[model samples]
Target: MKSPEHPSAGRADVRIVAASPDAARQVADALRRRFAATEQRSYPVDDSGGTRLHLTVDTTHRPEPAQPWLVSSRSSGDARTQTDEI
Candidate 1:
């Protein structure tokens, strides 16, 4: 017997299986945010109450973070002294 071939380096075949289609789609959407991904395809699991979503992502390119929390503050004062009125 021969072994199956894998995807090329920096490319991946991602599968999101969940109890509901919404759950699977959410996971696929998250992956799309982090990598260059193809449109997701959906399939119903055989005899199971679950949905399967498949997509291909290129790991070599990752998009910028949705929220840049690591950026340093430019303020001259200490962070503890900063005040914000809500």
Candidate 2:
């Protein structure tokens, strides 16, 4: 069977910051499920507090993969930023 076209296809490089590593993994897993062709990586914060997670997903495609949703913690103190490249 053929797959459905993604809403945000043709975009690449999705970056997100979460409250914890688990949260980041959860969000990445969710995105991977949503986009069958997504490649995800997570970086957990290693410090005294241990309350931050950074994640990056690279979706491979000819033109590019769709733009994935970013997951950021509400208590992160800074607003999240998103950028797109074509």
Candidate 3:
């Protein structure tokens, strides 16, 4: 598939899936330090029972990787929407 024009394009490709805020922060921090990235962002999910985080890097010298994370394009049971049976 063609790469996204933006990271959160089709669907947010969450790199860090943490159970708690602290855990998410640690993961984000680790990624930032390791990659020397500028920033990391996190989004909470109400229906998915977890939190998601992403780390982005901008570089013209090196081409970005294709789909670094395998995030689903479909919402499915994600917090954006849920089943009617609930």
Using TM-score as the measure, the top candidate is: 1
| Ordered list by TM-score, greatest first | 1, 3, 2
**lDDT (Cα atoms) of all candidates against the true structure:** 0.85, 0.53, 0.60
- 1-86 in candidate 2: lDDT tens per residue? 99854445554455667767677667766766554435555555566333443333335433235454554323566555646633
Error of 3 at 44 (Å): 0.5
Off by over 4 Å in 3: 1-3, 6-14, 47-49, 58-86
Candidate 2 Cα outliers beyond 4 Å, as residue runs: 1-9, 46-86
Over the stretch 58-84, how does candidate 3's per-residue lDDT look in tens digits?
332333334534563544665653466
TM values, all candidates: 0.65, 0.38, 0.44
Clashing pairs in 3: none
Higher lDDT: candidate 2 or 3? 3
- Candidate order by lDDT, highest to lowest? 1, 3, 2
| lDDT, model 3, position 79 | 67
